[model samples]
Target: MDPAPSLPPSYEEPAYRVFLDSLDYLPPTDVERIKSAFAFSAKAHAHQKRMSGEPYITHPLAVAGAVVEWRMDADAVCAALLHDTMEDTGATKQELAEKFGKPVAELVDGLSKLDKMEFASYQEAQAENFRKMLMAMARDLRVVLIKLADRQHNVQTMSAMRVDKRVRIARETLEIYAPIALRLGLNKLYRDLQDTSFRLIHPHRAEVLSKALKAARGNRAELLGRIQDGICDKLAHAGLKADVFGREKSLYSIFRKMKDKHLSFSQVLDIYGFRVVVDNVPTCYLALGALHALYKPVPGKFKDYIAIPKANGYQSLHTTLIGPYGTPVEVQIRTREMHNVAQEGVAAHWLYKDDGESSADLQIKTHKWLQSLLEMQSSDSAEFFENVKIDLFPDEVYVFTPKGKILAMPSGATAVDFAYAVHTDVGNHCSAARINHELAPLRTELKNGDLVEIVTSPKATPNPVWLSYVKTGRARSKIRHFLRTTQNEESARLGERLLRQELLSLGVVPISIPGEAWDALVKAGGQQSLEEVYTDIGLGKRLPSVVARRLLAREDIQADKAQHMTLAIHGNEGMAIQLARCCQPIPGDPIIGSIRKGSGMVIHTHDCPSIRKSRSSEPQKWIDVEWEPEDGKLFDLRIRIEVKNTRGVLAQVSGAIAEAGSNIEHVSMDADPERLFTLLRFTIQVANRTHLAAVMRGLRHIPEVTRITRERGGEA
Candidate 1:
């Protein structure tokens, strides 16, 4: 082995010695290279100091020490030592590449934040920085490992920071960094980050909890010892050689459970737990059997995670039992390998020095998660951050495909979420689902072991209603992307039609307008292309009349001679046009159009009071519009019925509406038991005015109904 290199005279001896000892497991060449990297980073940050007044090099050395403890590769350790060089010093990536090679340079670069870039807000900047790190993480997992190590050191040494800054960093650490550590299966680091952040964010609460935990531990020492002895005796009797360890819940975990479950501290059970590490998979189950025999097992508390591992590749058998004195005891049974994986997660691959099946499985799971981050790259930074945040805290439920392929999803995930998990196209065209061989709605929440078969149709498109219930970030982002794309395309088409109509009214041939004229319009509107200008016009952001006038500015045509043209309304225009709910205009109603910025045109009945008020206030927004022939689309209209307060009256009115071939979309009642009459409001879907009238007439036939009138002017 190569001798350790001499350090700078200013270096802290004890910290450097500890860091050097961690690299003893590496080869001589790797150790020498890492030493060279440390020398270069020390020179780069020699003059800098942290907020705690410690030498800045100490921070990088601490980060490197963490990487070594995680058993990361030599390159990752080198990158961790130089993580802040490019961001905080004059050190360039090229210099690092020439000194330590390209992989180390890339890792260091990925660990650096985008502090030099300008953003609209602090949140935006944070999101952009996170997005950049995640993209780099997708390419090399070591990038985030180094970054997490860097963050871990920063949070641990943030006592000298201002209260506001400390709170901000602690909140970010708790929300993003801690969850990410847990997702990666770095259990020790996860708990450390969470507990440190909780202490910083709420010092008093943390102190109280810490004191209470100590008192509780002291009180339960004897009982816990007895339970541990009983478990060991049972395992020994069952002829299963195992190592048993007692564990306690962390203060943050205890506080979170109490807050989330609305439980008092005294009511929290299973605060103490035990882990039994056995020889192999079969021995794990055997240990579980022995533990169950030692105590009465709690029903619905046994989970065989060994049969179906967690999304992060965690595998174990968990059971809660009623121990002596009727107290609940939690136990986890697993093999030695499973214990290593459960603790170290992806880092176990390097820690255990094994390329076994467990390591391969962890790699596959991590790869899938990284692939999802890549898939979400198209979203805006803030949106991408939110989506990733949702994914980082998943409580998973495993479901199966019809072909028997198992897929793990977040708890409360719907059929739509499953469809998207299968394939984006499947989700886009998903019409219905068959859950467990029975027809079910797309919003139906899937349970564990569900055989979910998605029904797709070529003609079916994603519904806006799906956004309300889809649980997965992938599904939510996909639906939003589809809606935005479809809306923009439809808006551009509508803009073209409106512009062409206006051009014709001005006595100009729509096709005769030169490309130069269109280019001029785009420039005037401060847009990238003519299509964008048209989209703006269609979205009501730019008035078509104003654009038409600008197009004819160079022509010798009389602008005053232009005739007004009516835009025809078709119900199938999609998101480019909306029917105003205030009036609920049907195909046969006399309607007018009002341009709503960023919302396209809204159609309202000509006599609607809301439209009248809008016309007087904003005359330029009003446009002459008329409805086209009905295309068999249903329109919703609210109707009020005055009926006697009697039993079965609601059922009778609903039955009469159904008999008239109309569907009741929603219904509500305002009643008083002391009065003889009650008012019922119904929002029903019908073909047109005639169908609505027929439904009203049928309602009048009910003996209990005194009068009926269609509601208008405002929301019912």
Candidate 2:
């Protein structure tokens, strides 16, 4: 699809030459391929101009330069050069494939958007584009590398666009692209993108931070120099050969620290740090020792990444030291190889030719993460975006498995996340977990270095509740997927049973309807088939009684056999219908049913306040419901009791409940320390309302019980 006509170019050659110069690491043939792709893209947009009034090709050329700076593959450079072609210039993917070959064509395809695919809203369009780009990146990590480069360049030149458009793009870059860079361990790109986006999205805040940082750097110049010189001399005296460089934290990093910690600019420490890159692992430790000896090391502030690498494979010895004039200075010690990994992250294998560890190892890790994205891909665009973003945060904690393997998970991840990280099967069948050899709840937050053991049972399965506390997107998505499948299966069964029961009670007595009549019934209800109708009925999307009435009215049934009857509910209906916890209605209560969307019948006492509130707005949702006699089952009844604040009051209350033949399933206390009385709430299992009344009467007989009341309508 061709876009609006582009403006004429004013000047471009010297910048293009500079871009070509950055490709010194590329092979001569690869360089020629990049140039060829550039020429093709240039020809495609020969008459087009960017918002900045330059030949639109300059944007792609600039993006290619960023990709080259990232040291991406030759195909990435070619893709970066032609990233806009298919999206803007009416250049078809097939034509690009013929010219640039399949790999480059595929990279370009991944980088391109479905601009011609009409969407109902801008958000829908954006979500679709975001999902498309991420899936492409999942297949080829280079796709995101090139896309981030493209975004970096765009954000840099966004001032030329309309103000609202510029702000929108900047916000997108900050929220999406910057996090991806951090997740990939591209510190340089991450920082650059963050700072650029920060400047555009929050210019005033960025300006304030920039000024504060400049002043701080100047004020500490002398002290920082002394610290750097002392570290260098100490390392040399220790017979360690290393390069000590002063590293100033980026403005964006400082801004984040201040904002997240709620600290002022001056209160943010570690704004200026030092990095010591040595020749080998032994030298790295020796350098750390020397630095620590020179400056008093801060206790509990040391992290030995060399022993336990981060999830992104970054390794270093990080320690904070009290520098000259009481200023805190952070020092990072790593081998030259480690330093490269620290800076470039996963891209280090390609950016700098490594000797021992090949790019294959890094690629494996990348592919694992990308595979998770593919696994969690959803048809709902917004859901897909949200789930993928959950994986982009870089903060992590390292925990151990039952065996000695260390698994890195996101911060705040629970034991359930660890189970899933181990294996999908283990997670699916996880029943209980032991953290550090002690039984712990599945929602327990995992700590670093804790050894976790997950116990599984053959009958165990994923719980929907796990989604509430799971930190990892993989676990949340998997649990949700399992629940959806389970719900569908259960709903289908329940729907069938409900439909049959309704028909039998209505005296229709037909096993099946004629195929044509069923088809007409389904089509009239805007459904695909009779099965969906049943499933919907079971899931409460449609009332089974309504569906039966619709079908029975059309089909010939003996009028004499038709009986006006209300179906008897036995309270063992599974998910087809549930007794509302708000009222906890048993067989003897005057109960009414509400057909909730996607959650079949909910039985509430007729006097329930919640039912009364919903009844006005949705009178049709109310259905006549009754209970069958002799269907012995337990139901929960909540009662609140006020007792004197004296010793053994709880024991007495428990004894009274046991004597009444009602079990106290749960108890909560709201007691005032200085008051004469305390309130206790008990959720007790009883056979019926009469049984509950007996329990309440038993509690009142106790002298300590000042006030006793049964709770209903969502109280207590």
Alpha-carbon lDDT, every model: 0.87, 0.81
RMSD of each: 2.4, 4.0
Clashing pairs in 2: 6-48, 6-49, 7-49
Model 2: lowest-lDDT 10 consecutive positions: 1-10
Clashes of each: 0, 3
Tens-digit lDDT track of model 2 for 89-164: 8888899787778898899989888788989888778888988887887778888888888888888888878778
Compose the digit string of candidate 1's lDDT tens values, residues 436-455.
Answer: 99999999999988999999
- Superposition-based RMSD of candidate 2 using all C-alpha atoms, in angstroms: 4.0
lDDT score of residue 9 within candidate 2: 58
lDDT of 1: 0.87
Residue pairs in collision within model 1:
none
Which 10-residue window in model 1 sums to the lowest lDDT?
1-10
Candidate 2 matches the true fold with a TM-score of: 0.91
Best by TM-score: 1
